[model samples]
Target: MRILLSVLALMFTLGLTACDMNEGPAEEAGENIDNAMTDAGNAVEDLCEDAKEGMNAEDEDC
Candidate 1:
């Protein structure tokens, strides 16, 4: 009898907790996309700066 009551109590508690869980993955995906876009933009900006520096150095050497 005690074991049955314990099992039922555990099940009820877990049910209530699980019911509140957010199962949608869209928010996580959106955050990932935003981070990726920021990284890409930063990388492009860095590349442009490096290229500009190289061009200026070449100009100085010539």
Candidate 2:
């Protein structure tokens, strides 16, 4: 029973080692999301500034 358990453990470890595990794609996706959020935030800030300037403009035709 002890030998069987050892063999089973060895097989399980080998199986885990044989599988492919990587974080490259996940890291790239996270970076892309961060860049997108930054761009969106900047765009919104610019839009808000333009709106404020328009609201405060002296011209009545807007």
Clashes of 2: 0
lDDT of 1 by residue, 1-62 (tens): 99999999999999999887574798789989999999999888788778878777553221
lDDT score, candidate 2, position 20: 55
Residue 43's lDDT within candidate 2 is: 86
Which ranges in model 2 have alpha carbons more than 4 Å from their true place?
1-23, 57-62
lDDT tens digits by residue: candidate 2, 1-62: 99999999999999998785665888889989999999999888788778878789664332
Give candidate 2's TM-score: 0.53
* TM per prediction: 0.53, 0.53
Note the residue pairs that clash in candidate 2: none
Ten-residue stretch with the least lDDT total in model 2 = 53-62
**For model 2, what is the alpha-carbon lDDT of residue 51?**
81
Task: In model 2, state the lDDT of residue 25.
Answer: 82
